[model samples]
Target: MPQWSDYTNGQRIKILRGREITQPQLAERCGLSVVTIQKAEQDKVLSLTTLLRIAGALGVDTSVILGQQAPRRAMSMDDRAMLRELSRAVHDSWVGLLPRTVAAPSADELRAAVDACWARYWEGHYAEAGAIVAPLLEAATAHRHEQPHDRQATAWGLISDAHRLAAYVANLMGARDLAYAAIGHAQEAAESAADNMRHALVTSGRAWVYLRDSRLKAALDLAEKSAVDIEPRFSRATPGELVAYGSHVNFAAVVAARLEKKERAKEFLSQSHAAGARLGEEIAAHGTRWGPVSATTQAVGVNVGLGRIGKALALADDIKDVSALSPAAQNRYSMDLALAQAHARQWDASLDTLEETLTKAPEWSRHQVLPGVIVEKVGRASTARLRRVSKLLGVSNPVTGGFDTATEKSAL
Candidate 1:
């Protein structure tokens, strides 16, 4: 077993560095002087209260510092290199510090900084984005810590966006738990701000996460509730262009489909479509991370739930390769295809599609979006028919059913 003392000072420092926080910074955040933090780092003996405070400051758990578990190691050389670049960018951006007497930066400036981060990140310049926004995030953290009332709500709201974006990138990079934790922090800040749009988005994002995890009922409940406060809580968007509200409706459609509530699914999908149309023109004019309300992917699922095999197939054909979507979306599309193929009695095609969906990525499993789930449903039905055919053919061993044996375990 790896013990706490097994870690060297260098290792601890590396962990601290990777966390993007400094000991002195933690001290400042915890209302302790720098010298006290220096002693703790040098002695590797942090008080429980100090550890808790530092952990909170770093958006981590206390076990992280107590060495209860080894810290998250860097991934590839690419990940390490990227982290270094990001750290450097953060440091360089903070090179100038106006006097403590100077007024803190304005919320609009921080919001602009967040926007710049997204532009660079979307362009695939991870380091540059990291550099541009790292200091801004740090400064915001410091401001909230030192001067709690200075634009407190706005500061937390913007900080939530920064963390949420980071979580998005992290999920793309395959650090799932870390991504979840980042989103959790973002939600906490958003709630602290009491900003409805941000709050709705955070809940909508979690519903998406739950959908990926195959918790359909949980996803449905959260998504529906999220959209309830759309008009009353936040006037951030027009009544029709409430993008987050549209997303909730879409998620509800997905859950309804998964639960085999064909009528409910169709109703929700139509509502989503209407909401999307209302909101679409105001948005980027192009779709966002959430697919269009009338997305063929969602339509495919609705068709499958309704047992309209031909309709499902028609919708599936219209969908482009949906692999670029998030795992939840991809799984929704793949499962629809699998179910449709099974309904059409295209056994080979159904098995092939299901296998293909499962093999795309490992997150497909951890996140519980396995296409094999629908396969199992079809497999049982096929087995009974095979047994009937075998009796008529007088064959003890019949290979009529083409279903993979593993599908038997995935029955709905």
Candidate 2:
């Protein structure tokens, strides 16, 4: 209900600009005339350039200015198929609808399988990841129930992770309700297992769900609290502890940046960087990764959302290598980097970054809002290049900041 999607574009801009910044102030920030700002607020047709300027000035995604993104993206066919099966597995497994005839795998085998699925997901092979987890959800659930009451903790934790994996994939594909349901089940299982590490992990996972759902305050609160609860005493902290703590604070920084609490986001970023420094390199654990690379990459995003474009670009420049990050993380960094580049008026560089993001992860890019935004800001774009990029991203009209899902389907 607090989201901006229900409002007209003009109203959304005014609201995002808020009471603190008047039209003149916004105009100054956007480097446009006050008349231009006034006309925009009057609901006149917004050129892609004007809209992109205002959206950047307001520190929001372009889609958020026009309205939220379309209720759903055009999902890849393979992803849709996998989601169908994933949805069935999530629902059936949650309601105690275990397949009676299925042979259950060992707890260790199932645990490794869930981790493998997550690895596939991070590699951006989403459908393949979903294929592994779709049936694994049911199997994990069935196996947990088969264990003796006193011996079920391991199985319970496995079920929680399996469900969490399902939620991660589903959430990215725009299956919000399914993601919520899967996460609900994941939390319940984690609680039942009484695993401290999993409790924090699930909490972080749920916070991510809240962020995608636009539950901004909830996401911030959950992430901050979970981070505090798991904060490591530097002298004695282990690698896993450091990873979880760093990931939590890094997410807290993300939410804070999005909420425009620039100073608080800065503090969290410092902590995240320190945690990463302690680890010296990326540590993959608990379905996530954290380290110097993770912290620095996320810091660029935080700076971008806070509208510190120069700072974002500076941080990005220092990140000489990103191969340590996951494929998904790399694409996401390219998104933030592109936005920073666009805001800095390095239009060519921005477009090139956008090209890299989409070419490297076309299917993964489908669900993102940033590509379309980047296209709108490319002032020097060639018609043929724009047409190709738009088709690749399925953005029929960047002026309105919405994708045509049908068009997206055909572009493939």
Candidate 3:
């Protein structure tokens, strides 16, 4: 049997709570949403306030929640360095004064840089993405000031996108404060741009922030309202406008799922899918990957969140190949598939899928809590595979004896 020290922070919480306390019960006690509790137990991005609430709900000291009382493995040097760089980039974007008299990159050059940053982000090269965005944000900000009025609009759009990219990366890293700062900057730039589509895009980013913070209903409302506000007449909508509207609708569907509004979620998802079909091809507009494949991939997670395990698996099957999607999106969809499979008691199949996903995107897998959650569900049957995955992800294997139930509830 593995010792308590073998478990991750999330696993420890699960162990302490025992099977008697389901996630929904724990969430209710903590005044948090079920998704928030699930994320916390998976050791995903969670705020300090959330940690404190969990500790309180479980009647445990905060050190238990932080895993400070237990001897545990430390994060790798590479991961530590990446986090430091991410924090620095977020800080710089919020505080560093813009330089005056800076020669600006041509519009084409700036566009190329933004394009590269988005590519890196989608590829799950978050640290590399961070390295590019700081300079891109500075240059765009400086250019907005230096360029003539006619060019200023273009520069503002660039600045808004750069900040939005920063927020997206920071949010993925679980840095909520940094993500908030970046979103604020994005919104400011969007206002200056005076483009309705740009404002709608920033609103979508803000909705993501709310979702991450466990404000499910708020996130859903914001996403639904923004999608409605920016709903372009499909017959005449530009590619960018279509992408923005579709992305917002997609996010709203996920939020609705978390809220357990099944019918509403389905309605939003159908709308998003229709938008994607109209586009016909995957479009990465302002870093939102909106298209048929992307919409379908998102639907898998939505189904998982809605507790439709069989439905989620069916959706996963529909996505014949995810190679065309961004690396980040591919991994996300894979996680959803694995979660659904595990819930259905297809242990071997779940392990196989997870192994393939981790191999394809090791770095991205490290930050995700789903793998850990799945391992916990499979218990002793998954020991060998779990160890390999733990070594690959540089995290501890979840202990199997924590939950009394044969099958743990889905944590999607």
* Best candidate according to lDDT: 2
In TM-score terms, which candidate is top? 2
Clashes of 3: 0
TM-score of 3: 0.75
In candidate 1, position 319 carries an lDDT of 65
> What are the per-residue Cα lDDT tens digits for candidate 2 across 252-342?
8888888888898999999999999999999898888889999999898888888888999999989899999999889888888887888
38-121 in candidate 1: lDDT tens per residue? 766676556777666555555444565656654333233335344444333233323433235434466777666677676655
Give candidate 3 misplaced runs (Cα > 4 Å).
1-96, 99-103, 148-151, 380-384, 400-412
Sort by TM-score, best first: what order?
A: 2, 3, 1
Would you estimate the TM-scores of all the predictions? Answer: 0.51, 0.78, 0.75
Can you write out model 3's per-residue Cα lDDT over 276-388, one digit (the tens) per residue?
Answer: 99999888876767889888999888888889998888878777877768888888888888878888988878878888988988877765556776767765564556667
Off by over 4 Å in 2: 1-71, 379-384, 398-412
Q: Per-residue error at 100 for model 2, in Å?
A: 3.1
Which residues of candidate 1, in runs, are more than 4 Å off? 1-150, 169-176, 231-240, 280-282, 285-296, 301-309, 316-412
